[model samples]
Target chain A: MEKGILETLVGVLARPTSTIRSICQQRPIGWAIIVYLVASLVSTIVWIETGFYDLEGMGLPDVGMPTIIVGSIIFNIVILVVFTALSHLAASLLGGKGGYGGLFSSFGFASLPGIFVAPLAVVGMLPMVGALLSGLGNFGVLIWSLALYILAVRENYLVSTGRAILILLLPTVVLLVLSGLLVGLLLLSV
Target chain B: MSRSKIIALIIGVVIVVSLIVLFFGQEIVPPHPRVAIITLTGPIQGSDGGLPFPDTAITPELVRGLLEQAEGDRSIKAVVLRIDSPGGMIAASQEIGDMIKEFEKPIVVSMGDQVTSGGYYISAHADMIIAQAGTITGSIGVIFTHLNVDGLLEKLGIEMETVTGGEHKDMFVTPLTPERRYLIQRITDAAHDQFIHTVAEGRDLPISEVRELATGELFIGRQALELGLVDRLGGRQVAINVAAELAGIQEWVVIELAPPVPSLFDLFLGGGSILREMAIARLLGDEITLLRTLLKTYSLPRY
Candidate 1:
């Protein structure tokens, strides 16, 4: 009983379970990352082609719907396939179970917390209170990331803290670099 | 702590600070001359459906009241127009802009989280305008929005009632007549010209320079400063300090404008979102001034 109590205490001390459901329950994180990325790409294409971003600028290209759709699909497909493969490799290394679904689930879950950015940025602009809240808001994101790490620990597929940290860092750098390269290529091609 | 209790603690601290400032903080400083804090909130004009969303506009009446207060009061060393709006209708925007120009006193505009088109219009001529570095501003442009309510009306088989010498007299109602589009364009151009003109004059930028910003784009405070839209980049406390310094007041009081009434959330759930609470009370019974909000929103596509 005492041992059970101690283990329970440790679990609680480890921080509350993410309550985000089982890691693989929703869209597999790996595929979800691809989906999220693809959606983002599509949204950007729509924004540009629809002249959404150009609303502020006096003039912008008269890019048609066909170009926008084709561009978005092509970009997203490339992104999805690439990230899917990488996530698979990561999963294999971590001794993760299953194929596409498991890898996708982990990838998807890792980035879920970023959705809070929209609301956080919006709310952060308030005056005296806003100044105070936005200062605190960045911490919530950090906590969310830590919570994901905990979730990973909770599942049998645990990493050495250093390996886990590296896993997080490498993928983020990969995405950023990819996005930057794509943006540059798009701009240059245009 | 449980989330509720943690939230409660935060509330308690904010309230304590606010109260202490309200009641006793002024005694320590030397007598700083008084700065007028004209209460400006809610829809700008008469409250008969005058906004895209009352729950989200800085009303005409509020602007009018502020102007009136400034004109009437003499003890007011200077006026600090604290604006917290995400922009609103062209009419309201213009009216408020006119009021600011008419005001005789030295005024300083202090933008909160969001002081966009209409809000910026009201404070453009202040001796200075201060905004937080992350504060969303600019959106120095104009637009007209029309929702396709014709389908809903058709579904309900709601027939229109009209008696007009001109066919397009009710130019704004939707299923927007082709003639109405022309009229709207004229209106948009006029408002746009005025917006560009005011920003140009206020920021001392060339008309062409201002036109660059007139793309109806939104900006962070830093960007706004770079664009010459805002005079300073800081939040309310900085605005307050600047106002005090400008007014030559050594020991003065700083009071926030109270909401006209409690927000729906405040009425029921209570706590959280002082902004939303203020928004709910002031904006209820207002129309959705969608042109500015839509324009501003579309302008900020992140890619």
Candidate 2:
């Protein structure tokens, strides 16, 4: 039986491997999009509350709050799409047979950990231990989310844990190498 | 509901509550009496986003926004304008000065390393001016430069033609005729007089006394204190104390009205300019860096 959205969300955290396998089989793209949207909106709200877009105090040009909110959400959505696409390509290159829809759905659900950023940001606003705790909490959330993503990739693609990690790292490594080469060429020309 | 559903509901509630609290917490809580510190650094210009660098100069719009924030906040009982500038455009300085003069609450100015010309124009209207002993200030004059590049152009064998609807339309590029010279002199003198009068009015000194001190001469903080240009010889802390004292608050929190914490976007945008500036600073030392900045910011008809 197909799981409910709430059950699947919880399962992604509670039993990521099994839950992600179910998600891949189910391909709940609409629910996945909704989850990603909520995560992005929460992240943007936390950022605003933490005073991220207040440029006036720094003597910089004031970028409108609305602009930041909309821009950041759109930017995050684009990143998710691109990341999922790149990871799908990487999985394909590694002889995985996962459909793009399944990977995208699982990847979107992986963003559920980002909602914790709101609470962590509040903890960060504390007087003394705020920053440290917030930083550690955010780091923890990132790690947890990465683990979920790895599980999602592995289950969807029928890959080993090591191969899943490699698939995830492939996009970043390629991007960095390309950037470095471009910089090197520019420097040489200069 | 199942156990997972209950857990999810709890998590959902926690996130909703956090968002609501973060958004509305400040309004819900009673704020403490605070003294807001608004910094006026670098040359005071009309607006930000000047070439080479954008954030180096102080702008009237920035000052107005900060002042308005302090004015609107009931918790903020007083404001301290921490000014560190060599001064820039005349109109920008005057606009900021008018804001200071019109502010309902007590305002104090704390002078930094260099507060001269247009800087002093804005500070002159503050309820009190505090400066360190070594602070360089009091360049109380207006300057309008007419660059007659006709000579340079002639030397370069590049003759230029000009069409004028008015007699003084081409006065800037051409050599200043006696009539044009007199008109320009009158304008500068009027601006200088206005500066003297503002200083006298704000400091409660006689016009003659202020005039004597407003000879376009730079004075150290001690000399300014003696000359009645500055009220006291102290630093930012003293200014803050004075502001709090003036506001009749024995115990108060000092809130710096600063920019919001920069986001990743801001860092990405500002990183190039910051790195370029650092490189320049390293290559040419601090003084040259400052000179370069001043050159970039410099405009005509300034105090």
Top TM-score model = 2
Please give the DockQ score of every candidate, comma-separated: 0.01, 0.34
Segments in model 2 whose C-alpha atoms lie over 4 Å from true places: A1-3, A14-18, A53-76, A95-97, A124-136, A158-166, A173-190, B31-38, B47-49, B65-79, B103-107, B240-299
A1-190: candidate 2 lDDT, tens digit per residue:
2877788888888888888899898899999988998998898888777766556655467677788778887898798889889999999999998898999999989999999998887776554566789999999999999999999999999999999999999998998999999767744542
Candidate 1 chain B, poorest ten consecutive residues by summed lDDT: B294-303
Docking class of 2: acceptable
Please give the distance, in angstroms, between residue A2's alpha carbon in candidate 2 and its true position after superposition: 4.4
Compared with the true structure, all predictions reach lDDT values of: 0.56, 0.83
Quote each prediction's TM-score. 0.44, 0.78
Which ten contiguous residues of candidate 1 chain A have the minimum total lDDT?
A1-10
What's the lDDT of the predicted structure labeled candidate 1?
0.56
CA RMSD for every model?
Answer: 20.0, 5.8
Write one digit per residue (lDDT tens) for candidate 2, span B1-303: 998899899999989988887787667754567899988788887765433344467877778778988998777999999999998888889999999999999999999999999999999989999999999999999888765445545655667788999877865556778998898898889989999998899889999989998889999999999988899999989999999999999888787886333443434334434444465678877765654555444425789
Q: For model 2, what is the alpha-carbon lDDT of residue A17?
A: 84
Give a tens-digit lDDT track for model 1, residues A1-190: 2223223222222332532224434334444455345434434543442224342122234466666567666775575456656645664566655455543444444444443343343343343464368547757865865666445433423445555455445556878999999757743542
Computed on C-alpha atoms, the DockQ of candidate 1 is 0.01
